[model samples]
Target: MQSAIPVSSVWRRPVSPLHCRCEEGDLDLVVIGAGYQGLSTALHAARAGLSVQVIEAGGIGDGASGVNGGQVIPGLKQDPETLLALFGDEAGRRLIEFSAGTADFVFDLIAREGLDVEHTRSGWIQAAHTETAMQAAVQRNRQWRAQGADVALLNPAEIALLTGAEGYRGGFLDRRAGVVNPLALVHELARIATEAGAALLLNDAATSLQREGTFWQVSTRSGRSFRARKVLVATNAYSEGLVPNLARSLVWLHSFQIATEPLPPDFDFILPSGQAVSDSRRIVLYYRRSADGRLVFGGRAPMRVPQSTDDWLHLERAMRRLFPMLGSMRIEQRWFGRVAMTPDYMPHLHEPQPGLLMAAGCQGRGIGLMVALGGVLARYLAEGSREALPLPISPLVPIPLHRFRRLGVAAHLAWYRLLDGLER
Candidate 1:
């Protein structure tokens, strides 16, 4: 299918360095992947007066960054309490503060860059499908408010009024959360980075890397090489086997989305609140109303491996179950993407090798976390401080039974689907 938006109109050409030609000996930094993380890092480094270059195997935002659910939800996928238990109070608070600042950072960046990506702060609703889930939602809202967040608990009647659906028992609303045209945001960031004097190379894939004394020589498939003092692997899920040690450490899960055609204006009453919504299931279903009044829904579907043509009948069924008002609406688009997940479900930055840094394993919270991580990486590069980073940099450890990841993911999906059905 053709892109809804033109590619050329979305991304601009990168700016070539004037003083240092392409044949110059080395650059200050070479970022792999043109997704949000890489582009943000390139922008930050170039803004810091460093010669930076970004290489992407495909077009900008061709990966998960562009194809996600587009719900700019706050906090990590795993609960903040779980994080505290795992890393102790101090580190956990640092992680929570960094993550919670993600939404603020995104809104601030849009304002600062003047990007027209259709960003809105209409808020997000975390609904409960069961009584236990409802209690969890209320508790989460209370905890977030205690931590100084602007959040409110919605009773059953409030939920019905906000969602126009009787399925949700209760929920909470966070006005700081919102949605965006993710592809548009990525494209705007790429443009802003280029305008800020950063070089971004599309269709240039990093094939291999070698440490050249105090510098790094990164080779690309297009018979090109970049010599940089430091290299950041912000490839995320599309790392393409570059770092075998890292590839084995994380579990990549496939998440799929389906967007319906813009509904009639009469249907606006169904989602008058314009709040993005998500449930608390293990394989949760998250959805939001688009600026043009389309319902974009997404969730984890049963999949043995990552493939474009995997059947989406399950997602369609789920959509019908949640909002039967659009049962007859045609699906305008369906897409899938893989998100890097850690056992602890937290994003991590790894110093796999000195001078060569890797930051990924964002789970499903990559959008905001990636931006925050980029800013942190920029600060770390500018100053000799890892303290600026939101998440801790730890040693890479391969997921157990790495070779059977596909089977493991399939089993996990089946179990979650079964659990969702049982709960219903």
Candidate 2:
């Protein structure tokens, strides 16, 4: 309802070059990758009085963190019931509670840091694409409500009223969910982390990691090296040969999104609540309106980086199918990013060995969860208490026949599309 903060002010801020006086021995932590996880962990670790340094192959937020759909939904990619089934009652209950509070944690961080990212806590809608899906939404509403979540099922009438579209049979709404300028948030986090006495090294790709005496030695492509007591590999899907068996442990898929030009002045009653919407399809369709009134529509794409606007044509078609009025809208921007997926569709925290920690496989819900996990990691590093973590530490389980993962992912995508078409 209110105009967003000037994007130029947030997105155009310059990143200062890395000036590290700590050399190698004095560094307490060396975090790889400068996306949400790395920045969040750096911020919390620095706040806890650790000498932290973050190394990014590209600029900050140059990974999925910058190009995400920006929907701040709680919980993991797997639903509550599934979590309970995967983990037992106690662990699953803890995870469910943590998931429920993810949005609150993110919003509070944004406020405490005085971040200018366009944050809106209007709500989020999990639209049901089929009758069976709507029934499942009811079940989810009941499950989460029983677990103390403020969620509700919306019938078709309410769905139409909320989304301004008749394609969805029904949906579930979570009031805690919202959206933000993801890139802006990333920049602000990096800024605050550095301001609180952390070093950020951009264009410094980690070339090799080794154990040198008591500290972990991390060598960079720029020929600089840092040795720290602890090392965290937070590079999710973009981890190209940085860590052994890291990229192979999860399925990497491409997600593309396109933004429309600002709607006409007369346009109204379309997502008037200003909430984000995601539907119940294996290859899901998610969208939300930008602060400037452009509808940002996004969904799954082929497993390749998009080269031009034409690569987003399928996304545009998907948007038109949901809201025919958008058929004639002009496309203003197109982009794609890789998202990681675990076998169980849950974010994994791995401790392959002591002094080495890795967190990845956000499975498309990384915005809030990554921030919260960062805090958990900080606590673990500071207090050395793994029992206090919401997520249990597990060994990295690399996918079988890892080299054929691309072909496997393609087949899975085709199967999901077939299933979605049948439901429609």
Candidate 3:
């Protein structure tokens, strides 16, 4: 469906020039998917003097990158202690450091590129919905603090004052987190990438890929093709059969969002810290204040696949549970996007085939992670070693009975919803 908002309203810059044509013959790199990862990779590679060409199935940021809730949160989905237990201390520390740097890298890029996207570094809070969760938040704060993260464990009074809600028992606040206008950021990045000499081809889907001696031949449905020495698949959830190996390795789940009309000025008293807040639940609720004074909230909803519907009554009810004062607020916009989730919740960068790299499975945190992944992929493409990646790159392995992922996700969501109800 066409958006009611004008394109220029959300995107500040002009379309990238590379979205037009594909050059003849071979290129240094061909990137699939024009989301944040793809755009960032192209920008960094081209700026480093490589001939880069990016192909997108749809318009720039039309995928999850543009449709996300725009929370620029830090760290990976997996807990650091769990990572250390699984991969040992050294690898776990490396993983934590890499994920944390994602937010820093994003802010640095915004400043260096001088993009007009509304970025705010007001920090983020993880609110506890139950006593058990509150204890966990305290432990998490301690862990993060030991790792040099500027995190604090807030008391119930502080939580109530910060969130403007009495529902949360307590929580942890991290100053390293923030928010952004994701779509605008992607558009600006695409423009900057083109300015740096990278070619971006929107509406050009990479239909197939095959190895041609040392190079990879990537062909699009529009009869356009790119013979590149290196190809990076940054498609995320919209990978859509581009690489069978990589596709099978990840499961797709839909995350839905609804934004309220510009918040009343008095709402500031509720969020005195002016930070983004998310509840600690399996079916988590993440919400933040937009630069325009709107409350944008989102969470996982039961859906068979990626589809948008205006029937967001369930999500609105969920929002009201957090902020009863917003019960009368009108939902100005409703949207949904698919996220690629791995079995272990950790993102993977894989060399599914020789000379072809696949980076996906950011779960629902791709905004910050994708930029970091781009830097990792660029280094790998230039150096010819996955070892250069800050995070580990393991072989792609699909979840057992992967074809039934939707059923599994639906059942999980149902259980989580029940838990949320019980807690309430």
Q: What is the C-alpha lDDT of each candidate?
A: 0.78, 0.83, 0.80
Total clashing residue pairs per candidate?
Answer: 0, 0, 1
Off by over 4 Å in 1: 1-23, 304-310
lDDT of 3 by residue, 248-352 (tens): 788887777787888888788667667888888878888877677777788886555433444456778888987898768888777777788888888887887
The best-first sequence of candidates by lDDT reads 2, 3, 1
Q: Give lDDT for model 3.
A: 0.80
True-vs-predicted CA distance for residue 211, candidate 3, Å: 0.7
Candidate 2 Cα outliers beyond 4 Å, as residue runs: 1-24
C-alpha root-mean-square deviation, candidate 1: 3.8
lDDT tens digits, residue span 148-232, model 2: 7778889889999888876889999988899988988888888888888888888778999898887888999978889898999
Q: Report the lDDT tens digits of candidate 1 across residue range 203-270.
A: 76899999989899999898898899888998777766887678887777777777788889888766
The worst-scoring run of ten residues by lDDT in candidate 1 lies at 5-14
Off by over 4 Å in 3: 1-19, 305-310
Residue 51's lDDT within candidate 2 is 88
Q: Choose 1 or 2, whichever is better by TM-score.
A: 2
